[model samples]
Target chain A: MYCRQPLRTIETIDDLHYNLQLAVELEFSTLPTYLQALYSIKEGSNTIAYSVIRSVIMEEMFHLTNAANVLIATGGSPALNSPEFIPIYPTFLPDNEKWFEARLLKLSPQALMLFLAIEMPGDLVPISMITIGKFYENIEKGLKYLDEKMGADLFPCGTLDKQIEHKYYYGGGGIINKVTNLDSALFALNAIIAQGEGAPNKHWDPDKSFPLEDTTGIESGDHQLFMQPRELSHFYRFNELKKGRRYVLGDSHNSGPTGPEININYDDVYNLKPDPQSGDYIHYPELEEMNFNVNVIFSRLLDQLHLAFNGQPKTLETAVCTMFSLKEVIQILMRNPIPDNELGEYAAPTWEYLSPEERTLSSIR
Target chain B: MYRLDDFYDLSATLTDYPVTRLIGTGVGNEYNQTLSQWVRQDVLDELYHCFSQLERNNDGQVCPQALRHQLLSNEKYGPIARNIIKMWYLSIWYKMTDNWSMTYGIPAYSSPVIGVESPTPEDYIISNNAYIQGLVWPLMGSHPMGAKQPGYGTWSDAPLNSIASIHLQ
Candidate 1:
């Protein structure tokens, strides 16, 4: 139901920036909910899922950084410390009064559904529709504003006229905009859905073979399968794993009000009980330490950039390279296991690790 | 109108010494060397090339008067030039205070430099912003040039405040 709308249109730099910022914020906003959900799951039962979630969280941080860099390059400060940064679970949509609501927090079947909804392809939210989804409209307006303000120099790569492709899409569907090629599209998909959804290729539904069947029915067909049925699997697998039961693949599970088949519920053999109140959650008090360590990493990276730029010919170049290095660190942390040791126990890799090749691009520094 | 040389000299003086030099030193040895070379050559070269077209005389030195005239007359380059100036200032500020928590090994709010004894929940935001701005703005010999000052306005006005609120919530 959520993925039925068309892609939101973007025309200008501000629109891109605004949406980009919102995407970054949303990525972070999902973390608290994700952590809560992960912790609620019985420990050791959802190792792969947990790993995926952690990776997504880390990549979200990367996206946030990328957005910040873009904002800075365009002469704007990346505002993470805004009240709007973290919305209360299920905040009201920007303009719509009753049509749509943006959920901030709350662990429910609907919560996961909402996650699925937000993450559905951009094109699903029909650009023509008004009441069903307004994100497209917002994007269109933002793009217009940006185009008016910045003109054609919006993209840093200087290939403004090139057709961009969508980052992530359902196997049978068309790609999202501004994601021209497979690499960029994959990168975008990775940034948005890579962590929480498991492997990128695995996201494709194998059962429903391509040349996607069109069932326009509101409560029947693909829409039903997409919204109500699939979400239940999220809850069911979670419940089964908590009870130490073997959650067979393709078995129907109820999530919130919806019911769906369990796609890949690995570690079903592990007998893990949910912490009564928390229920099926991963308990790691060290997460705070990880957060602090990340902050330290960011600080150190900035410090290094400052040193490398010392009034030299290649200051900007070095800054860009440092940005790339920071991105690599974020990527590594996303995949790495959570350090169970004391604070600052795990040593973060340096820029050298990020840039394996020691080739100096510029002689300015 | 004054010559291009004057503008080059002025920009070089502003970008090379004082704020840039100060921030560069504060960044420590490795960072300082990298930046010094970057300033003298890369950034300077770009600025000179941009100003060359606007140069009134063949002589390289463009006086302060000439610089002002170019800024006012040129449309395409004016905003970019101003932004570059602002960026330098912001860079200085960012470099100075980016590491407050790491440097002192204390929380953001409880900084002695900002006069917070036992930082209230609110104090953290103000102190963090002050620290960050303090470092970033000086490099360009300017501050965050906006109508809303850092401390004033809604808690949302200051980024640090907003961030703190989010985390606490």
Candidate 2:
């Protein structure tokens, strides 16, 4: 199918590597936007709303690691520090249609709707092989093609030692798989696809709901019936929040959430600046300090991830702690309101980490 | 059907605040079941028999003065009644043994460590749900951290009416 579509001419292993870097950047970009929106919700209200968004954000982190692991497995350096790699928001998701703009948003009806679209399973907007699902499908094909031609020397440029093992991640959705071979790589790719966008490899009917795992705790006596219903997909989970309810037993593909009403207090949310940039905080010294601390923690998180992928599993503890500590810093930023802003917005983390050179330059300035 | 309420009145002689108020915290059903389990069936039967033995006044109207005197002042039933109230308030089950003078007993009641103040508990460990549902939350005017979260900005406002009112709204 990828050969049938007009692709970006993947003639060599380097081309595959380039696309993997693009995948990494795409996965890395969503984390900031999701976290900013999650932190905007008031401390106690919207318990279900908080859990649903958090579940997605953790999976996005998992997806980032998966993409990097695949690149390392294929003997390619996973470049995370490139300047252009940090996405400019209101931009399209990696290979999404040009019309769908992914922006930093508060936890509003609008934000929930956008989350639904961003994670909408299946090729909702299929434009030649550009859907994220299709892009990964093409990567799977590229892996097979390289292996067939080069045999034992397919991934000669990279080493297995660079792969981030499953032990680094602390409790989330799927396991962090090492993609050393085609089967393992395909498993990792399928998790990214089915867990976010539905799988294309399974020969299930296109019109029918995608075959996902049944994570919904539905009570059932019939073993076959219980086994059949897939867990509500990520798209469906956000949709449940949008509908202001939960999915209960017997709710199916055609059915909506029939569970008890979830009381959501939207009026009490923090007013965060939409698509906030690192450049925007320069004028306010306090806000600038907040942004700096956020960046420092994030940089340390990346450094920890780098070390964990390189071989040391013990550093993952620091990575987990840094991930949680980022939330505390972002929470503080949420409390400090931005001045002279008519829109009634507050400070938020910009998700931009400065390198040592950039940090020295800022200090000098 | 023999309702547990027939055998014991948590509201009548136990809690100062209405027992129903604690029930409104949303952990009521499980809390009640756990408390019932903690107070064994034989103890409840003894409580029912003791309450029945309390003599009514000559006018056939039960005197509140006499009822308190009959229940709390008795030798055998006094501590058991007190422990029931403590179990509801603190969610900790005190052992029902009358052998406070005994030097030692079962392994469950094994001696405390050198620095520790008390011996190990023989009463079953209370469920975490019961601990969260303990009468203390209403006294503090807050729910447990992870369970039954009161809505956003609720802290700034007065506590829920459920804390004060006896009747279910």
Candidate 3:
């Protein structure tokens, strides 16, 4: 057992931008896997497990936005369209690269356990170690140090429009805000930590008083939800699902959710094969076609998001529409069984990025 | 003889919807059940066997023209194909015309038919679930009333495609 050395924090603006981009990719990497589990549920059978995974994925999207905003606020472009942005399946999440691998599997005991590990709270980590929470903490320190050293021009002027504010995103339960300056940027980091791995308290939403207004309204003038009791942060939500229970108001992180029992039948899930790839379906042309279709839309979404982060913020509305359209194809993939697999599993979208030559229907055919 | 895959392939030709999109509607299996219960077993088998012949033309691609000539225009299988399309788009399965039924009908008419205007029992909305998932919703760039709503402000966007474009290589 050797002593662990402290990992280097972001020391420059370039360092900050690079690390934040990694944060964006890191946050994004979990989505396909988590959504696979969410969509795998036979409709209305595992409603409890379904919603838990759904909420977690929503928060992960919010985290991606925050990371992109921080990268943009530091005068850096969010590079997302390249193939490198999408990590190969069964790959390690940057935080867990050294020890564990994340996979694309349907909701089962294994997937839930993987989620628990991915969102494991920093408080649970040994000191002098690097977890995702520690990664963010280092970014927080880097922001402070750089803001002091660089003085007034740290975050450049006229880049404020690049940040995705509350006006851009809407709907169910992810904290949306802008990152304009040091305070707002730091607040973004705090929200990521507080909601994801738990704040130092291990069970509190940072800035508890932050107002979440009517998600549908163009701007706030109606139905502002204030001081709603904190929902389970990511780590604890998975824990509750794994424990087959709920976390009540007074429960601590380690309390293991002693509320009313929740039931999820593992048999109700679609049998998604672990870590499917585009090449895996050469024998299954229609599955390949469906899989390719998913990649086209998925790639388009990444391009649209990149555009939204860099300059064209209004594109987000269209982006949201594009995101919703993905459900149909993914559902089709999940519901159909893989034709001849020995495991009798279903096909799933591999979340691969299509090259420009492969993007067009005619071109690929 | 009663394979869902053949039924899906057959349905794709009749409905002009991708097999994937057809399944995505969450009623393909139900539509298959509707076919089994309403149509004669031999007729269903005859219709599905056409897909096996699909391997002959266009290098194994699904050709609407061939299906139209062989099944859609056939006196025996034609009406069945038409009803399959209706069941998918409108969630209602129409009984064969009196002459066709007299010639080739099964006697398993389950009650709870939604169409009461005709003197004889005519058709049914398969289920409330089926009606809500009707292909009409996606076709019209809208959703069934009080179900699967895109959300609050989806109306402003351009109409999304009813079917994702399919490419076979």
Candidate 4:
């Protein structure tokens, strides 16, 4: 592997902004990869399995929004539109020390294993670290240190009005606090880490606590829409599936799921070729057409989400509808048989976006 | 609640599965709700009559495996029963064509009952979720392709048991 930039001390406000934008990119990158896998499941057989994976996806979206909220609060525009935001899979994560190549594939043991590793927390003590939770921790430290050194006005980049608050999102899990100062910024950062890694001992207390007053008052009761044990982390959830069981109240991190056997028949899934690019299918026009449609819908989703994030709350409903439509198109692609002498293999969505001009044209139509 | 359970009983009789289990976890009841949303009222009324008649033949009680004989023997109710079975398995309201009906061993009803008016009888999906919940997957020892997913590497193992006996019927 080629060497890259070394981790630097976050001394300047500009450095903090840059790092938070990186955080946004990191959060943004995982959605399509996770969604591609989630969508590739055979319809309706693994209802429980689908739910577990989908909960992760929803939380990931909340993470993306949370990062954007923090960035906007700190007076930086989140650079989500960059092509670099889209990951080149089997590639290095943002500032990871160990070479963990994140691959985009269908929901298989391998994909779930990768997901577990990605959410794995760093060294418990907050020294030099490599995990995503640490990366955000460093950003949190920078936000406070810079706030002291550069003054409280360091985060005047955006206003509360600009933040994508709780109103825009539908899921009742996770708080979207507007980060105007260091405390709120740290709150946002801690929330990210808590959800990603879990509590200090990895015992997720379901009834722990929630921010009581939702500014918009839309969210109520349970912080999560569905009830899951509070102590389960992303890593643990994936591990439970990897081990073919469900976790119980008294189970430790290393223990197997003591509850019910999560009897998942991984067979009969669409044998989608992993990490396919638009260029890979050019030889077959039919596959190419399917790829184009997938990209068009994907691009439309991003466009609508962009609007939704940029102070137009009504666009969120439209974005959700677009997401459901994307599922339909992706399913059609997954159902189509792949050409050649391959058994059980099926055509899959490439998850590419349409060209900018085409996106514009399609949006107009 | 009563009518819905009666419908489930009718569905269970036709599909040869336990009505209690079907009500608890099966898609039959859910599919029936969706069917009512778009299915023509008159056709549903006719189906209710047919189902009541079938139940009447069994002491006005829905019995386990009660209609299996009629599903095989009777001409008037056989095609209708087959369509309900198809809807449960495939989430498709397959209209009975005269030739296709006969070929499938479903003797056509003397008074033809046209289902919900569609431009054509080309099979259509019930709902996206309904399609995923279709009975065909488990009957074939497979999961639906794009909805509910199992864990990774789980597919590498062979299915522990086959419901091929149930499928064969």
Q: Judged by DockQ, which candidate is best?
A: 3
Model 1 alpha-carbon drift over 4 Å, by segment: A1-16, A93-108, A122-365, B1-169
Per-residue error for A202 in candidate 3, Å, reads 8.2
Q: iRMS for model 2?
A: 16.7
Off by over 4 Å in 2: A1-9, A127-129, A155-158, A199-230, A249-254, A310-314, A360-365, B1-169
Q: Residue-wise lDDT of candidate 1 within A78-131, one digit each (tens)?
A: 444323444444443222323355542223354455545443432334534332
Candidate 3 global CA lDDT score: 0.75
Give the runs in model 3 whose Cα sits over 4 Å from its true position. A1-6, A95-97, A172-174, A201-226, A362-365, B17-21, B40-76, B96-122, B132-169
Highest lDDT among the candidates is held by which one?
A: 3
lDDT of 3 by residue, A191-304 (tens): 777667755445554324322222211112122222233455678778878999776645565455666788989998888888998888888877888888889989888888
Docking class of 2: incorrect
- Can you give the TM-score per candidate against the true fold? 0.30, 0.61, 0.84, 0.65
**lDDT per residue as tens, model 3, B15-62:** 777787777666788888878876778877777786567534545656
Worst 10 residues of 3 chain A by lDDT: A216-225
Off by over 4 Å in 4: A1-4, A124-129, A199-221, A224-231, A311-314, A341-343, A358-365, B1-169
lDDT of each: 0.35, 0.64, 0.75, 0.64
DockQ of structure 3? 0.37
TM-score evaluated only on chain B, model 4: 0.63
Ordering by TM-score: 3, 4, 2, 1
Which 10-residue window in model 1 chain A sums to the lowest lDDT? A272-281
Displacement of the residue A329 alpha carbon in candidate 1, Å? 23
